[model samples]
Target: MVFFMNIRHLPSVFFLWLSISLLSLGGCAQWRPTTQDSVKPASTGDACEPGVINLNRVTGLSQIIPELKKARAVVVGESHTYYHHHLAQLEVIKRLAAENPHLAIGLEMFQQPFQPFLDEYIAGDMDETTLLEKTEYFKRWKYDYRLYAPILRYAREHRIPLIALNIDRDITTRAGEVGIGALNDRDKSHIPAHMDRDVPGYEERIHPIFDQHAGSSKRSFEHFMDVQLLWDEGMAERAAEYLNQHPESAMVILAGAGHVAYRTGIPARLQRRIPGKIVTILSSDGIKLEPGVSDYVMFPAEKQLPKAGMMGIFLEQKDQSVAAVGFSDESSGKQAGIKKGDRFDRINGRKIREIADIRLAMWNRKPGDVVDVTVLRKGKPISVKVTLK
Candidate 1:
């Protein structure tokens, strides 16, 4: 009944530059560097020292070994936009896989719709070019291909299976549109009862970016996470089903850090199903060793931003156009009928050259505020008064 699958390799260039910039900016919050002297390897047969590190605050990587040893599945959390976090996770998988050959790598990148393509790629039935085309997210992230390519090559060369564990994004989007509570009874039956419970104060914890752009998009980014969480739960259920059928095998799931965070995440759900399973978190802040649910945390030597800022208006150099992007809240550019191709000639009475300048010009504005925008549309100058949402 055991199904063997090989891990798929993805290109890694996209994350490298991004991580470097974030690290340099020092914008990532609550980050501190870990020196070799500060972190020591866990000793065999030694119980984790109590009070060795404060649980509420930051901790080192070696503290969670006891939990790691008991895990049948290890899910490493990562921040998709951060290069350091992704690199750290990849390194953790390599070490864990080397120690345990039965480990199979899984990914949140490939959706359910792409499973057949993934299967073909893993089976060596598809060529690299075709495989690249099928998994296009890799290109968008600009991650270096070599980092993930080696892992895929390792799986193929060593006969390890890589599982694609994700629901199709379209399905996820539909679920969000209808609200998680409105799914068909049959579909609802497939989800765990506990998952249906309304998360208390869920809206309070939403990042600032979501709060700002709630009006621009039908579903806010936080709502997107809610949908993603449900998708993750389904993915966990499927992974468990696969594992139950193959009791002798282990799985390593690669996903964004948010999906793998110990609390309210896939690792939490997986641990609930398989109590002794280990969960690891890898990030640029250095590895964290969480007790109880999480077995180990690995962080790189570098310190980087914990998360990327939300999408908002950015000034484009060509034509000085302000475009909306990232995960941010605020009215500017496109939401105001500012076409992507339009040049922002002026904001108010001043020439707009950068986002900071725009913000400075409109700092006191509220949601119902109005501002004058002069745009060069097709070489014709036009003025429009855009009211903020």
Candidate 2:
């Protein structure tokens, strides 16, 4: 199983959940079906068939691409951890890149501030390791790098420009806590220049889900609203800016399903800024979506990455080094002479000074890989070799 730990305050969980129930009832999106089996025009009030799109089985890419190619921007949504969703995203990107001479990929996984490193990586001017470090991938978008490694590798190999399309988490966090009005000027600059605070049907749909959470007071809900808008608007602005600058180029956008569904989030916001067709595609992870949810819903086969290497020990961050605070059941570290309070000095010859450094060292490693770890045990350096599990 892949584990992801966010280092900063995360956006609202409800937004991440995508309010399937609300979307299922009365969401609206502009989508045309290329095949008779794809989608049929139905009443928006038809609750039985949301947006009138067939939601039963997977739709083939051949039937979907004709409509997708007509759009200036195509947004592909993922469930983040579900590896197959990423495969679906990559398939679309590969097809689109092959046809469009000038193609760019916009990623919600990367923050807007790190575009330079992404540019360098795709240009082959920087190595993968340096790109991960410089962009702070392990610290920010903390999903196992292996899940996204294939997409990143392909982008770099093909020299496709990758656009970073997210605001920093700190900015979103502060906005959620104190509202956007309280943010300082520098932080404000990172947000969208103009926000559509009252997006049609967005608040009404999201409010009920917001109320289900523990702290659903009106004021808290306002804060939640602020965070969601900031994420959608901020990312939309970045993508629009890029599209406006290079009007001839087409972009494949990779983002969470919540931001793509119903075209009310990033897709709608981006469309408002740029004059062109924008198509939204969602990969179904057994998610029952309504008709206007996206242009096409792909049913992809299941995919799983190889199990990540694990030391099987809990770590505590010390000032100079990371310490073993505890061990999991049947921990390999404990079996290999590692003890609680032993501070990590190095792993596989890479200096391990922080949690991020440890994650970097283990990024490409798989289960059963053995490595030498140096630890400071009682003022003496001790070397222990352990098999990762």
Candidate 3:
């Protein structure tokens, strides 16, 4: 997870805009694989080594699974926007699920309040669109659904339990604004019972990242640290609760690299609740790691998703419609005579009331595809044909 903590700068909107922005940016790390000693058993605490095993080779995966299977929980880290990272995550989940009949997948994307929606999706009670809408996925976890669709679909197909391992964003934002003690009972209910702020090396690890975006203010940094703790501890507690309830099952957790790397984030907090075997794997293009970063490091080749259609316009929700706030240099809508301040009424035949609606309308569209768009210009509806480019 790229920690772009630019919170103090944006006062008009809640902190969620910056949070979503950080998640939207692509992961920055590059991959440089180096050889080390032979693979060893996956061990946590003091016994873990700083070795990274390359999963590209056949033997690398074979050597790791035996050790991974022995663990009660397996954590896999990912760069949210990276297609290859998700592919590797799915591969790991599939491999682990093949052997463990009671395998469950825990997600950091969805909030705990929306777990029922996930359960409904897995139970075939609703379609993908309904699932996304009910969970407020586009509003909360703004990353492209295409990046995670395969894993979600696979879980649904196999009837695998998908655990939502995050608390509501509102609670975190409120906690950041007012200290944990200032929060009301409703917000406090969502927080973990134990928010261990004294985890060894956690603050030291977060300091460098915090310094980059936040100025030299001890108060701001402390607030930032508080928010980070809430994130890790909240997720860990949710995961632990599920595992405790279903001791017969094993879970594969998928979260950002920052939370899993060095075992200082979710993994350590989780260990506090249940001292069972836990293994972590990090997928990176190029991220340097010290000893005990993860049990295995997978080096996947650079892969790209097929280009989606581009409108080249900045959109925002205004009143009851989605408004075109600005246009990019090569905006297809601008070329089609669509002007700024025009509100999107519909794309093709689908209603466009929000930013997510636009994405849904154009999800499968390509650059060369021509789309008929209806926009409200000063309360009058006008139709325009845009050739996406």
Candidate 4:
């Protein structure tokens, strides 16, 4: 399974945004989102537990939303690689925004440097692709942008403000190497005045991840820890800053669950600095659900962790129905009996309608595991078996 640590979650180097921004700003070649369905009713089960609540339970969902609607700020936690978590987040935002029209959506994907571009995008002054190009979306965030397109669209359609909530990666990378105390006046200006990082549960959770990336600076892990805390607190600080400017606006923050977990990451940091009522909602993708961290926890109907598995095929999305197979260049796709123009219907039993669906099904499968696939070749369903690699 693809593991997501609080520090290294979803795998990308910190503080490299400035360099990435200088690179080519070309948009992704094949960014496509599938048609969305009507909101299915939430599934529920017996959940009186403090930490874990079955999302399908109407009683649980009902109890959670009122508190969210009443808050000045709400944090919705997500696993970046999981599309379903994004869906759940959109649903929560959709429902809550209806109740409170003064809602602003803050994104973790776009950092502080691209705030102007995001503002332009939200203000209808620029197209989404241009905004993404200006923001270096592909290189900076690295996640498939289509997974986030729907939520962004809803915000744009609703005229909701999109707040960029991260600091530049160059500063993050610099802090990781030395310490925040070593920052020059220019870099220091970007950070907040105070970060109470000594929160009890955070160090125990983030230290090992920081250690792995610390290299020879293991002795200076405290410095690296400062960088990590700065990351969380930086986001929290930005969110709080936005709320300060628009006290009537109820901000819905879109961030990785790691930052929102246990109310010990960004939520903890934000509460110390801001006076508004804050609520944390965590979404799970089959990682052991930790309870009592967020005010409400949402679990998708399906539980799959993204893995480093490979199908070795490129899929082209054809409208809302299916992703047609395109290339098989002597990789796993060739061995899997997947021919060009085959329409994918399912992988390991997970239904496929787009390239993201294929990623959802195959991202976490182990390399050697054999799985069954169903595809429509020439208007007929066919079964093909492929061993993951």
The parts of candidate 2 lying over 4 Å away from their true place are 1-59, 208-213, 318-320
Which whole-number lDDT from 0 to 100 does residue 154 have in model 1? 64
lDDT of each residue in 359-381, candidate 1, tens digit only: 44554355556788887878798
To one decimal, what is the Cα RMSD in angstroms of model 4 from the true structure? 17.2
> lDDT order of candidates, best first?
2, 3, 4, 1
Best by lDDT: 2
TM-score of predicted model 2?
A: 0.84
Worst 10 residues of 3 by lDDT: 13-22
Per-model C-alpha lDDT, please? 0.53, 0.79, 0.77, 0.69
Write candidate 4's Cα lDDT for 1-389 as tens digits.
01122332322211111111111223322212110111222223422322222222222344457656877778888889787788777877888888888899988898898899888888889987667667867557768676788898888888888999988888888887778988899999999888886787788888767657626355577776887788898998999888888888888898988788766788778787778577776764544443244455565544344455576777677985565555546567667777778888888787777666665555336777887999888879989888777
Residues 55-158, model 3: lDDT tens digits: 22233354466667777788888889998888888888887888888999999999999999999999999888878878888888988888898999999999
Per-candidate count of clashing residue pairs (backbone under 3 Å): 32, 2, 5, 11
How do the residues 1-389 of candidate 2 rate in per-residue lDDT, one tens digit apiece?
Answer: 01111324322110121213223344444444322124344455644554222222233465456666767799888899988788778888888887887889999999988999999999889988888889899888888887788898999899989999989988998998999989999999888879887776678767876888996798999889999899899989998999889988989999999888777888889888988788777865645555456656665667788788898999999897899999999999999999999999999899988999999888887889998999999989999999999
Q: Candidate 2, after superposition: displacement of residue 94 in Å?
A: 0.8
Instruction: Score candidate 2 by lDDT.
Output: 0.79
Worst 10 residues of 1 by lDDT: 13-22
Ranking by TM-score: 2, 3, 4, 1
Q: Against the true structure, what is every candidate's RMSD?
A: 15.2, 8.3, 10.8, 17.2
Clashing pairs in 3: 30-285, 30-286, 31-285, 31-286, 50-291
